[model samples]
Target: MKVVNKGLRAVAVLEACKGVVSLLVGFGLHVLAGHNMRQFAENIVSRLHLNPAGHLPSIFIHSASSLTDARMGLLAIGALVYSLIRLVEAYGLWNGLVWTEWFALLSGAIYLPFEIYEMIFHTSLLGVGAFLINIMIVGYMAHSLFSQETTDNQI
Candidate 1:
């Protein structure tokens, strides 16, 4: 079945909206993590040579370090990249660019397997929703991109 321009626009809006939400969420995580890290620093100051190494303190220290570590940076970068991708998709949707449709669909499809695994492992309703949305977007993207190819070849 062929997908229409409206479908493309709707998909673009949906994808871009998700990016905005993700950007906000990533910022929220950074803020929350920063708060926890500040509290950890306070502990180090007050305990000053009192307990060189205690289990709970050590765990907190490690947790704080891990939370602010490289993975967080990677996550931040990923969020930013996805935000740009979403913006590009929005533009592409407005212009009716098939490349954007293919890109969004392919990327969305790539995300689904991981999301599906997360839904099963974490058993979260949110994860399930994300997986389902990705699944739906994949179809629209694929249909639009595919139809474009067929039309182009006829010319």
Candidate 2:
């Protein structure tokens, strides 16, 4: 009765990777809130060798400078919470929990509309790839959920 599906394992790994990246980004943002953010932004621009006078670079700097400490804190908290959720989902999926399959399906489905919307308005190779990947994930998880449920009912 135990399931160790390869597709679910792949989804688990992907979720775990997302969680780790989110954690890193959250921690970085949290730390930046307590320091000289302007200096940090400058350091980033310098390391990237971006032209300070360029419009894009100026917009980036302006946006960075405009982020208040409270905003950064909120963003960090949100990221950390999201990371925790993804990690939990990954754990459940890796352990072959049925709830995690439902969770994964719902999560992927929830983003479907947004992805489609973005692709409609801003079509690009990367956007298309992301949309396709999400679609595949959603499709696989949905299939797994329904097939398992049907088999269980038959038994």
After best superposition, candidate 2 residue 26: deviation in angstroms? 0.8
Candidate 2 versus the native: TM-score?
0.92
lDDT of 2 by residue, 1-155 (tens): 36678888999999999999999999999988977676777778889999877888887778888889999999999999999999999999999988888999999899989889999999999989989998999999989989888998999
Minimum summed lDDT over a 10-residue window in model 1 is located at 29-38
For model 1, the superposed segments whose C-alpha errors exceed 4 Å read 1-4, 26-65, 69-78
| Best candidate, TM-score | 2
Q: List the residue pairs that clash in candidate 1.
A: none
Error of 1 at 22 (Å): 3.2
Off by over 4 Å in 2: none
